[model samples]
Target: MTPMLLVMVAIGGTDILFALDSIPAIFGLTQNVYLVFTATAFSLLGLRQLYFLIDGLLDRLIYLSYGLAAILGFIGVKLVLHALHENNVPFINNGQPVDVVEIGTGVSLAVIIGVLAVTVLASLTSARGKAQNAVAAARRHAAEYLDMAKDPIRRADIFGKLLAEQAKIRALPEKYRAQIREEQELMALLHRAHAEHGSTSAR
Candidate 1:
C-alpha cells in the first residue's frame, strides 16, 4: 500500500478476477448475453460515484482495513471454490454447486456497506473528543502567560522573551516574522504612549 503502483495493481487485479467469476455466475443464472452486458454497463457507470463516497468515508472507519481484509479473504476462497466446482474437482464432498462466487460477492458487498456505516459514526465521535482536547490545551497555555504578568519587571522581561520565542516559531513561515515584528513594534509604541500621557498629566 505504500507504493501507489502496488495498490493500483492489487485493486485492479482483484476487480478483474471478481468480474470473471461474476460473468460466469450471471450466465449460469440468465443465460442472456445482452442482459449481462446491460447489467455490467450500468454497474460501471455507478461504480465511480461509489468510489468517491468510499474514499471520503475511509478515514472515519477505524476498522476499515480489517473489515476489507476479512471480506476479500472470504471472496477469494469462494472464487477458488467456484473454479474448482466448475472443473468437477471431487474434493468438495458433494457440496451443492451452489454458485459460491455469487454468495461471496453478496457477503463482501454487505460487509463493505456495514463497515462504512460504523466508520462514519466512529469518526464523528472521535472528532468531538479531539476538538475538546485542543481547546483545553490552548486554555492551559494562555494561563501560563497570564501567570507571568504578576510582577511589572518580570512581566516586561517575559514579554520580550515570549516575543523572541514566537518570532523563532513564526520565522519558518517567512511572512510571519514580519507580522510578529509589527506586533512587537505596536507593543513598544503603546508603552511609550502610556509613559508620555503619565508625564503630561503630572504637569
Candidate 2:
C-alpha cells in the first residue's frame, strides 16, 4: 500500500482500539449510558484538535505512557472490585457479595488527575525528556524546512527553529547525547536543509 494509505489504515486501527478501550473505562467510571455516549462522542470529535494542539509537545511527554498505564490499571482494579461487590456467582463468595471496599468516583477522578499532573511535571523537568524533546524538535524542523523549500519565508523560520534545537542538543551532556540513535542521519538532514536554504537565498 502507498504511504498515505498505510497512514490512514494505522489511524483507523488506532481509533478503533481507542474506542474499544475507552468505552469500557468510561463504563468503569459510571454505568450511565447517556454520559458514556456523550463523553465518547465529544472525545472522538475533539481528538484531532487535541492532537494538533499538543503535537509539538508530545515528544517531551516521556512519562505519558507510564501515567496512562497507571490510570488504566487503576480503572481495571476498580472494575474488578465493583464486580466482586455486586457478585452473585454461586462459586465465588458462596453466591454472596464480596465485602471488598470499592473505590469512589471522587477518589478515582482525583487519582487520575494527580497522576497526569505528576507525569507532565516529571516529563517536562527531566533531563532525558529535554534531550528527547530537542532531538524531536530538530527532526521536525528539519523536515519542515525541506518541505517548505519553495516558501522562502517559512523555510527560513523553520531553519531558525532547527538551529535552536541543534544548540539544545549540543548543550546536553555526552551521556544523554549518545542516546540519540540516528545522530548522523539527523545531522545529515540538517546539513542538507542548510545547504538548500543557502542556495535558495542566493538565487
Candidate 3:
C-alpha cells in the first residue's frame, strides 16, 4: 500500500479501538441493532473533532488520564450490571435475572455526557487558574524588586528578573503579556538612566 493508505489504515484502527466501548454501551439502551448503529455512528462522527480538541488540551489538564479512567470504569460497571440483570447462567441466581434495578439507556447517556462535560470544564478551569496564579505571583515579586531598587545596579538586577518573567508570559495570549510589556518599558528606562550616570550607577 502507499504511505497515505498506510496512515489511513492506522487511523482507522485507532478509531475502531476507541469506539469499542461505545458500541456495546449503546446497546444497553435498546436491543434494536439499527438504533445502536445509528447512535454510535452519530457519536463517533463528532468524536473526530473532539479528539483534536482534547489532544491540544491534554498537556494542560493534569488529571485528564484519571478522568478518562473514571469514565471507562463507569461504563464497564454499567455493562456488567446489565449482564447480571439479564442473567442466564444456570450456576448463579438459580438461572434467574438479577433483582437490582438496571440503568436505562437514556440515563446512561445522560450520565456519560454529564461526566464528560464536567471533566473538560474542570480541567480547563484548573489550568487557567494555575496560570493566573503564576502571573499574579510574578507581579508581586516584580513589585517588591522595584520597591527595593534604590541604586542603579539594584534597579538593573530587578529589570533583568522582570524581563525574564516577561519572556515566560509572552507565550500566553492574555492580559499578562501587557504586564510584561510594561516591565520591558521600565527596564528600558533603567538602562537609559544607568548609561547617563555611569559613575554612581555601578555601585
RMSD of 1: 16.8
Every model's TM-score: 0.33, 0.85, 0.54
Q: Considering TM-score, where higher is better, how would the candidates rank from best to worst?
A: 2, 3, 1
| Higher-TM-score candidate of 2 and 3 | 2
User: In order, what is each prediction's RMSD in angstroms?
Assistant: 16.8, 3.0, 12.6
Model 1, clash count? 0
- Candidate 2 accuracy as lDDT: 0.85
Question: lDDT per residue, candidate 2, 17-74, as tens digits?
Answer: 6666699779767989999998887776666566666776577899999999999999
lDDT of 3 by residue, 1-203 (tens): 79999988887777777677577666655779898888777766776668866664664565567767776777778878888998999998989998877877788778777877787678656635345444544554456554664565776676567566555566666764565456675546545544544644555
Error of 1 at 23 (Å): 7.0
Ten-residue region with minimum lDDT total, candidate 1: 129-138
- Which ranges of candidate 3 are over 4 A from the true structure? 28-30, 43-50, 127-203
Superior by lDDT: candidate 1 or candidate 3: 3
Q: Which ten residues in a row have the lowest lDDT in candidate 2?
A: 48-57
> Across residues 1-203, which tens digit of lDDT does each residue of candidate 1 receive?
36998987876665555555456435433446898887666655555457756654453354566655654565556556656656554556554354543445455466657865665555445543233233223333334444643455654554455445444344344453344346554446435534543554486
Each model's lDDT comes to 0.51, 0.85, 0.65
Candidate 1 segments exceeding 4 Å error: 1-36, 88-203
Q: Candidate 2's error at 14, in angstroms?
A: 4.0
